[model samples]
Target: MDERHDPARARWAVAGLFFIVGIVISTWFTRIPQFKTGLSLSDAELTVALLAPTVGALTGMQFAGRLTARYGSAPIARVTIVLAPAALLIPAASGDLVTAFVGLLVFGVVDGIADVAANAQGVAVERQLRRPVLSGMHAAWGIGAIIGALSGGAAIATGLTVLQHFAVMAAVTVVLALVAGSQLLPAGVDRSQTDRESPKRTSWRTGWTRRVLALGLLGGAAMLCEGAISNWSAVFLHDELAATAAVASLGYSVFTVVETATRLVGDGVRRRVGPVPVVRVSVALAIAGLALVLLGSPSDIVWLAIVGFGLLGAGLAVLNPIVFSAVGHGSVQDTGSADTAGAAIAHYTTMSYGGVLAGPAIVGWLSGAMGLTAALACLLVPLVGIGLFARVTAAAEPAVAD
Candidate 1:
């Protein structure tokens, strides 16, 4: 069968890699305390070590566009998946804080490269297939997180050392990535290029540049909501609602499941409601969900958080794809070659990741001082703003070709 008709299969392949990624990233967090104990590192020292991933991600984002352009996304993705497991080994085996920090730094680089490649592939596939398929690709990442969290918990409970658990996960990730790499299309043919005609290139300095920047900022805000939920939802359930271990953990799990399901359905939602209206509706749902989490009764916090996160997921789902699609429009006009579309993907990704790092740190500070409930309440502000911008951006959107 022609690949365009079967893009879902490609998405599934990508999702499986994301699943391994989830295990690698989340499993280590549970082992953080154990690592600190083993390494005899101070909290301040651990905090500095933890920043390795963010720093690495920022650095990787700067060059991923050119790397993907030159080497193609497939090679970068395959290599990253193979190397990601190595990151898990260091902290698991280390007797010193420095080793653990080195592990995280390496993990960060692997994660960053994989992230850029996967998203570039997603955009390329979606444009070729001429449908909104990126959300489902992301939904795979959410599913992977659930798997990671559960696996990590089980390993911890089973008395498996961090090293042992990570080693197992690494082996699994390497095998899966290698298998998936076989199926992925070459980025050159896989990518969308309207024509081979080379047009004058536009720099990121003026004209629609401001608009692109604005879109990036808005995209970053959406990412903040996602990052915040991932990092802090469990803490909120535990401290605010007084939930038990199993019950509290459900906060993130429930959110992830709901988010994944809704995202699978997001393309349909956009097709029926139109992209702008869907975004508006999603933002409203997020507000309601946030309100429910902050003000709902103890019996309902989990369900409320689930609903809010679902709304958050659904609402935020289309933003990234839509933003890239918009950038593709600009690039096509400027460069007369749609392959340059991936550059827009790079720009927006950098912007969104800025929020990915900042969101957790910001909320951690708020939760420390003003409390979790207040931090959750602050999320509503961005949701409301997204609703407003959805209207303006929707009105301004270039006509979608059939």
Candidate 2:
């Protein structure tokens, strides 16, 4: 291996990529209200616009595995990361629903591809290190999200326009992506060659087996909860709860801050207690957190809702990382080839992104019909589903290097 592919350096570089993704996503999420106002969209119309990204992400995930296999994860990630920030400018500058929809669609496709590539890099690094570091890498994402949310909230308070905030964020993201991307591992490790050399090779069909699908489902459940909160908590606070824009943004800030704090210690916990138990406990905590929000909503107690959001964030912090790590660690039996892992990851990402696609629209439609309170309370359903499927992660074992 090249000195540049040193596990330590690669780990930090991948963390940096994850951090940049987090920043761009959080920056856009924090400005959802601004987008809504700028377009003068109804809740239903906003739901329709949000669906654009979901569609783009699903479309991108279909091709991400092939792209990663053909060109390597690094180059694909580098291009997408640079493109992602630029795409943000589209929606931020949009003065109508059509433009916002188009902008979000482009941004979502780039973001979806970048997401899989970055996680593929993280999985590769973890396999090299032969330890649990995925949780910690994901923590960097939480840290970036916290910073983005706080900065965006402050910018809104100080009279910054959507274009101004997005432009600065985009420039910062592009610079960081180029610098960090240079440190990623070089791409040419072929799975076919590895399979020829190994004692056994997993068939491609193994990547879509029941166990893998179950793990993907668990991951999807987590993403759905996270997506809903990221896209709606601020809206819930600002509009439904009648909070000022600054205070509304704090809901997301508090959530990400607590989530980040949990992730700081998540790796240690995973190594100690193992992934299954951690997931079960996380699901339980998430249920409790959402219950608090449900309880608070009825009483108009903003503080309670804020605290609940914090707990929800903490519960969700480790889930996707754990699922991704499980996939990298040969969670699917006989599926340890590099290509198999990449394919499995693409499948997992597709399922997870489905949740993201459904979340905003579900919240929007339900909130429009019943009420935001009832809409949010519905998150409890999926949290329970996660607990039921927690055992799937236990099947994973460390990858056997080719």
TM-score for each candidate, following the candidate numbering: 0.83, 0.81
Candidate 1 per-residue lDDT over residues 304-395, each given as its tens digit: 66555555555566666565545544554554544544555567778889887788888998878987788778887777777888753442
Error of 2 at 389 (Å): 2.0
Point out where model 1 deviates above 4 Å: 1-8, 190-208, 237-247, 297-314, 317-334, 364-375, 391-402
Residue pairs with backbone overlap in model 2:
none
- Model 2, 1-402: lDDT tens per residue? 788767778889989998998899889889999889988999999999988877888777777766666666778888998999899999889888899999999988988888888888788777677667788889998778878888899989988899999998888889998889888877754233454355245343435767668888888889999989989999988777777899888888888788888888988898788889999999988998898877776467988888889999999999888998887565324544566566678789888878876788898899989999899988888899999988878744346444
Screening candidate 1 with a backbone cut-off below 3 angstroms (N, C-alpha, C), the clashing residue pairs are none
What is candidate 2's CA lDDT for residue 90? 95
**lDDT for predicted candidate 2 compared with the true structure:** 0.81
State each model's CA lDDT, in order.
0.68, 0.81
For candidate 1, report its TM-score.
0.83
True lDDT of residue 249, candidate 2: 88
Q: Number of the top candidate by TM-score?
A: 1
